[model samples]
Target: MNYQYNNFYEILEKNAKNLKNKPAYFLNNRKISWERVKKKVDTFARALEIIGVKKGDLVPVLVGNSIEFIVAILAIQKLSAVAVPVNTFLKEEEITFILNDTEAEILIASSKFKNNLKNIRNNTNIKKIIWEGEVENIDENNISFSEILSNFESHEVKELPKRNDLAVIIYTSGTTGKPKGAMLTYKNFFSNIYGINELIKLTNKDRFIAYLPMFHSFTLTVNILLPMFYGSPVVIIRSIMPFSKIIKETLLKRVTIFTGVPDVYSALSRAKLPFYFHWFNKIRFFVSGAAPLAGEVLERFSKKFKRAKLLEGYGLSECSPVVAVNRAELQKPSSVGPAIPGVEVKIVNDELIEVPKGVAGEIIVKGDNVMKGYYKREDATQQTIINGWLLTGDIGKIDEDGYIYILDRKKDLIISKGVNIYPREIEEICLKFPGIKECAVIGKKENNDEIPVAFIELEDNAEFNEIEFKKYLKKHLANYKIPKAFYVIDELPKNATGKVLKRKLRENIEEYMK
Candidate 1:
């Protein structure tokens, strides 16, 4: 795909000139225009440069889903510095590991996570902490973000980042070992913007909604960056809880492009709404990412929202996170449509040889959206990206029509009763059960054999009955594929983006089993 701009800063500059006073962002009742956005970003960039930040410097951002998050990141980009966005939900240890691994000198974090920053100064190379929310007083190290926005003057960024320069370092979830930082360049992000826009259609006249965590690649590229690149105003919803707020904002703000995970779609599909919301809401397209869209959820969503299409997409952090999605006009039942324009997808065997279309193998992707490399881990980087194709470590297959079906994670496979069982297949079926809010299946040892066990979270008014659940499972799954046991928990462990963290469940399975 041909990159449109040299970097994000260039795009922001162009939007300032052409879009003028159009809203760049909306938070609650506040509207920030592109003109104001450019000014704030420039001033923040100057503030960053004043505090000893230089080109190629890595600045870790720990802000939440607010306008300040966008401003802080772009401001870092304006000075040609790399912005390392860390998950604010992480504990002190996880956050420290990333800060130390990146060797970032400056840290930008929201004050909501202030308790996590108690000894952050002594733990990492952090020399300054630019706090984004309410702080009683600003110390030498703890600088008030409000002060910068109000006191600093906007200055021209003499050296803007190029397409090849490193733009961000997104850390993997580190399910197995230490999290590896995927280094993404400006061109990588631009390629994703170019590739996705070709499949999913939207324009500057539309408004995009972003409630997912910004640290996730899907939210960063699709929700945050894509709309900005297209010159559309983005509605920044800080949290997804009390989901009614999202629905109200959608109606009030006239949001046309909605992006979320499977849980959000499932809730929206099952949620009974007043006819007025259905008749007047301007939701033209609903995009699902970060996890697979359950078929049952899609079917219910289609029946519920006839005017909009829930285009399910697949992506990972290493590929600038968006590889493919169902087109707005056409969609397959369970497949993540075809690869976006300019991307190549193939099912390959263990040796990286292409397999038959219908055969399940490793899914590898080749495109400009692929990351530059994993930071400071040449061995891991080489293993991930081979011959310009990223080995997704996901077991899936390409259909004859080019639609892709993700069967399961390679490591999450279960061999039960001498047959291979994919947990997602069971989990997807379980999600169809009434009163089941979320379901997660994992392989556990039973005697000498490995069996599939389920951990579920039920709806508020729903109770789990073993006989009823087993009956529900037996209807859709083979005896061997059905979970050997069911455990009802308050909630399923999830990452910031709402993807089920099976590794965590597997690690702590014994505690729940007893």
Candidate 2:
């Protein structure tokens, strides 16, 4: 914990020398500035150090959401290497099993994922492929990330990297299965943008849309390194399901920060267009974390956008993700604000101890954005970073003004007759029902015990009525939080950065209990 920020390419070369000519990013009608994003991140960090790609070498990229994924992740951290991004929607045997499990050798990509990695280029060992635009046959040892940034020359400035090495690996969606590699560092991504810029302030005339998924650590630290650590601008947007062009690129690019999830605010509260389908209040704060939004999607965007606020935060992916955030003088509609400055939140018990205020346990944390573990799996990083806290398999509590709340996932609770439950409190009473749009719940079993089970999704031209959706979830649930069964689905199985794949909805309830 000695970080006085040791080089993330010297904080993007000091925000490209103090926001030189400002505008930092606005892809797809191109804006770019911070001095042409620091001369294309120093000519792609001298074309990734003339292909030897040094310091911790991982590279990978596989782009989509361009500015060549921000000049290949600040030119793989200006040659300290380690980026690893991928997930240009995976699959080519999960992108050659993460370029043969992160032994990656510089594969940068985006000419449509280099034409889908040219059909698994003879099963990738990777050794240099670059490719961002004109994709032709690529066989002759592939190269063309704008011709390796026009054959690099940029020179000098090198030696910086070690804030505990490894910069980014990410991967998640393992859901108790395969995908591992979390790693992170550069002091877990610059102490999570200096601990969420000590609670969100952001600058360079703000902006922010970034339709989540720069291989998501909530858009790699809230819309990419917290809006490139305040030289802000962002925009990006490469599909988070076309909500009418993400509401025409957040109200014709006036976008002053949007950051969604919880199905992009229940698909813009069931969009029909002409903007405000209840609260897009022309940006400036909409937030909502990677999942859980329903309090009827924040009461229909506060009864149709009464000048937007929606906020609700919480974290995971081992906390470079942001721990608690609800902001605006700590507003707590379902909590999650409070613990940001140098982060500490407690809860414990199972002998780790803490517990008191509003009881529920296991949330832990201790900050400078917690992570640096899980990559080479040290027994799954000693069952998740013990001595300095980080447990967070989440089950929360805190309130008494320190906010927090959360309560479900400690492996998504629900014990049934032995009591517990919390399927996000019956998927927030089956998302207050009129056409339900998205839900999950999951507990199921029965004769052998357990119970709950929901899996919904509805709303595209509605009509599932199911006894008025269980009498509008019995007027906001509590018959053990309702849902003994629902199962609708036109979609609901996310996770590539869209959350809700509750283990594929509990393997579709073990194939409907076989």
Candidate 3:
């Protein structure tokens, strides 16, 4: 199939040519122009090539959101190398596993995570490590990302990879087992931007704030890639905490585009410093995704920021992330709006047959944005991408006007504060503890919100300390991954197939709550 331009480097080049002297990024109280960006990207690509990083090789980027992150990603693509972005919050073991699993030969990690990388460097096959911050005594095996650009020289652009070639490997949290890497091609990403651009009209003048972690699909495609494609100036915000800071930056910098999860909106709605500082309404719009946005939160935000519309949407890592979003003018509450252009959505039954409109069934999507497949997992990919439809394990239905409404998560994954937490992954971690014999993890509703709960059976005549257990968990997992409460049980409920019946666990919680 003949495709539109697939190489994202080429997209940046085209945009840079048009807006050469225009401001592209505001970083550390400095403005970078598009022309300067183009030259830096080319120089960084040459630097990567000189360091023995080859085309199609997986290079893990663990840097924070900055112009450097943008440059590294574009530089890797310029050299036909695939970019593997890792979450900075990952534990050492998790980081090591990702590097090994992706076969990442070159690692570009931030200074904050350099110590963790140093501890695991001897255990992995990573050929080289480039720290984002300055480091001394690093031999030929280790280099500083700054040093690469210090004596950088501009070079001719290399031949770009085809659109179908793999460009990114975004690992989604695996509910049933290990996290699987979803291979997204250049075509997949551009198609997503194409679909989104057709629906949400963003211009070069729009100034978007990068709030979500760049490792995830939501921020990667929407916040970073989309803005760059249109040559929009972006303000990068590394932290999403202390809500006041985010609001202050949005108001002070005059950011037009705001995208975050429900937690961020909920916090903003409840922010009560003073009425005189209601200047957040200056933003053109706000977008929420990665979880269901409560209608109450939306209403409160609308009332607080009367002029700006709060838009909610849906998608997954496998779809190059965005499937549908609500239009500001034609609004709907509690609905994920319609499927973006070039994407097809369907509610299907067990036999893959489409269900009638308004009936609840699994939501399926087919489009250029659909991922190639789970890397090296053909069986899993086949099961997911059947008959050209990427079955999003989300239960929902569409109304007569094509508005998609998400009812429940078809997969047993818990999304707390926009981060995906898989039951199996948590259960595995709990089982590794000394006393735990068997475990089942489930999401229980608290104040109409979802939180992770774990039921565990102890060993024969075993004793456990909840306080110490909590500390142990904090050491191994992220704050959100740890369970809110742990219940001690004699045995876990399971079916004939040996699958833990998480439904029963949730039901037990309901009965107990009642």
- Best candidate, TM-score-wise? 1
Q: Which stretches of candidate 3 lie over 4 Å from their true place?
A: 1-4, 273-281, 413-514
Best by lDDT: 1
Kindly list the per-residue Cα lDDT of model 2 for residues 1-514, writing each as its tens digit: 4556675567667887887877877777878787777787788787677667887788878787767787788777767778877777766787788788886766877776554666565786776687888867665357777766666767655486777777788777677577877777777667667766666677767788887777777877778677776777888878766557766777777887787787777666655556453344356688888765667677776676667677888887777777778887557677768777778888888778897898898888987678877777789888888897878787878878788888777887878888887888777766665666677887876787788878788777887867767777777776776777777767877776567768767866766445
**lDDT of candidate 3 over 1-514, digit per residue (tens):** 2446868788778878899888888764788998888888888899889988778899989987778888898899888899988877677887888888887778888887776776666777788887777687777777877877877796875578888899999887543456788999998998888888877788998888886777878889988888987889887877676567776777777788998876678667766856645644458889987766766667778888887888898888899889999987787877989988888999998788999999977899999889999987899999999988998888788999999988766767676766666665566567667766667777877776678988888878989799999999998888888999888877776522123556667767855444
Higher-scoring candidate on TM-score, 1 or 3: 1
TM-scores, one per candidate: 0.97, 0.33, 0.80
Supply candidate 2's per-residue lDDT for 50.
68
Model 1, stretches more than 4 Å misplaced? 446-448
Which pairs in model 2 have colliding backbones? Answer: 185-188, 278-304, 278-305, 279-305, 446-449
Whole-model Cα lDDT per candidate?
0.90, 0.75, 0.80
Error of 2 at 397 (Å): 44
Q: State model 2's lDDT.
A: 0.75
Estimate the Cα RMSD of every predicted model relative to the unseen true structure.
1.5, 21.6, 10.5
Candidate 2's displacement at residue 287, Å, is: 8.6
Q: What is the Å distance of residue 101 in model 1 from its true position? A: 0.7
Evaluate model 1: give its TM-score. 0.97
